[model samples]
Target: MQATKRPDFIDQQYDFAAYIRNPEHNAAPDGIETRRMAIYRDLFYNNIENFAASAFPVIRAITSDERWHAMIRDFMVKHHCKTPLFLEIAQELLDYLQNEREPQADDYPFLLELAHYEWVELALSISEESAIGEDVDPNGDLITGIPQLSPLAWPLSYHYPVHRIGPEQIPDGETETHLVVYRDRHDAVHFLEINAVTARLLQLIQQNVAASGRELLESIATEMNHPQPQQIVSVGAEILLDLRHRDLLTGIHNIPER
Candidate 1:
């Protein structure tokens, strides 16, 4: 028997392609082609594909198997995501669908919006950045005229009504929607349907751009255009306190510290 020469191509990369397609070429060191390699390959790809597909099941269910396989293959080759957790694959796919601005933009106009909507549920579900807010000496008194929003809370609005968009409810055209994705005390995911004005107010509060509770309320009232602005301010103050109680506001910090 002739000795087979080792290829120069072996490097740091795991050489998954060779392992999957040409397992005989690189047999196990024990001199037998173990069934474990095929098992591993099937599980690896299937796990990733299943995990990613689960996040966007509605989209996946509608898509043909051929399209899904092609899409996943393209993603596998093109994207070099950082996280090993299968759950994060949805995020990377969402980012690729959203931020990929090129000639191919027309190919998937609503794709970005859909992906964004899909990511909302997953984002709130698996977010490791838990609530870091602590109670002050005076819980209610600490709520001065200023309040800070939580680091984990996100207020997002999308051009497409995501909550309604599924295989069943998908309309002929895109519809706008507003969403607030936040983690509760139990670390459970919660979604809220907030109005555009409220969403904007939450956005400003989350970004720390609006310094004081008064500023947030005034901005909201001005943007929304209510009859009495000061009246809204008092109402907004109560809302801010409610948000604080919900752990939505971390604490009132200086504008510079934000």
Candidate 2:
């Protein structure tokens, strides 16, 4: 026996949703007034476009309105967002830019990286992770004790200076930009420009959470083959202290001297 057919109303609903999402591609459902359909389409598209503009203001500023609208419309029609949360929509755009969408001639070189930088700020602002525990000493020793990088801290490396990119300063040549983005106890998100050495040091600390400041510095000094290993150690000590003060390194694990 043949299976029963689905209701026409269901098909109509699907057609309507598709049209609302991408009126440029999908025609409006039959029997819907053109005026009413226009309202729905405008409302849906405007909401998404506004959200995207607010999330990536730099991108909005750089792109022409026609181009921006087309881009957002394409994203709305093509991208299948994973999360229902509105805040995650920015992430969906980032994923779309990074993985799904092909690079267009008019697109900025740092478009994806800049979107990612913006999304990081939003993600950190809404993060549920608590600050360092009360038991952790903020002013603990840097050399002897194990250093713990905060879950809120993130080390980011980009091919372009995403933080500095704007309508005026566009990327010209190949340049590596390293940044550390973190949230402090006050619930404020901060961005810090870092050098390759500092970036590598943060990476090492993140990978080896149990390593002491001195041990990490010694490894770095050895890696660099510095003429003055002691100087590296001294500077590393200062860096760790500064990181701790900024709440990026929550605290140190106090271990008794051997």
Candidate 3:
């Protein structure tokens, strides 16, 4: 069958939206007054700009107005967001920063990482998932059982120390940063900066989901080639307990840890 022609009204809608997105290149649809078109342009742009501004306030604060407006324009012109919902603007901004936005000479080195860290905070804050589900025992023994990471808890690693990126404390050098972002039972989101060992331990739990706490620690000890495996296991037990206390874990696995 031959391809069906698109209706003129559909094409007109596309033309209108394209111009609103980037009036610099695409011409305004015919028969509309420039003054009226200006109103539509400003209204559309302002709504998007304002929502994205609230979504990424730190980005707004750290960025100079001229630079920030220029970048936001770049986002509007280049990125095709999948959703029109205001709540998803932060995620769209993060996607633009990571995948689409071209780097500028004045762009901060930590810009992408900072955006990701902030996006995680915002995403977890609005997530509907419960911290401790019925399957998870809030008071379960973490050391003797197979500990499970919570769905609400996200383990993240970055080359830059994103949590400390601010006006006065801007980092000039790279530091390996590991954080577990989680929402607590009280419905508060928190970021916990952890050492490489603890980060690796969390990874181990996810990898060996059926392994008991002692087994996981032993595996870590073996991975580290430590001569004193028992000591590593002992310390790891305490670490598991600490994570459990902080609601970082979803209690012990339902299957037997032994």
- The C-alpha RMSD in Å for every predicted model, in order, reads 5.9, 1.8, 2.2
Where is model 1 poorest over a 10-residue stretch in terms of lDDT? 136-145
Q: Rank by lDDT, descending?
A: 2, 3, 1
lDDT of each: 0.66, 0.88, 0.86
Model 2 Cα lDDT, one tens digit per residue, 1-258: 999999999999999989988877788999989999999889988888888898889989988989898889889888998898788889999998888887898777777888999999998999999778555667788788878889899999999989987889887965899999999999999999999999999999889746788999999999999999999999999999899889899987776567
TM-scores for every candidate against the unseen true structure: 0.74, 0.94, 0.91
**Candidate rank order under TM-score:** 2, 3, 1
Q: Per-residue lDDT tens digits of candidate 3, residues 1-258?
A: 999999988898998989998999999998789999999999988988898778777777788889988888888899998997888988998899999988988889989988988889889989888666566766777776678888788999999998877766778899999999998888888999999989999998877657778888888899999999999988988888888888888788656533
Best by TM-score: 2
| Winner of 2 and 3 under lDDT | 2
Q: What value does the lDDT take at residue 148 in candidate 3?
A: 82
lDDT of 1 by residue, 1-258 (tens): 999866745431346554543344544333324576668657767877888788987678666788777677656655667787777888888766655433242233456676776787788778777466554222443224356666667777777776666666655676667776777777777777777666776777766543566777787888778889998788777767666677666657543443
Give the distance in Å from residue 176's predicted Cα in candidate 3 to where it truly belongs: 0.8
**What global local distance difference test value does model 2 have?**
0.88
Cα-based lDDT at residue 32, candidate 3: 86
Question: Candidate 1: where are CA atoms >4 Å away?
Answer: 1-15, 18-41, 99-108, 134-138, 141-143, 223-227, 251-258
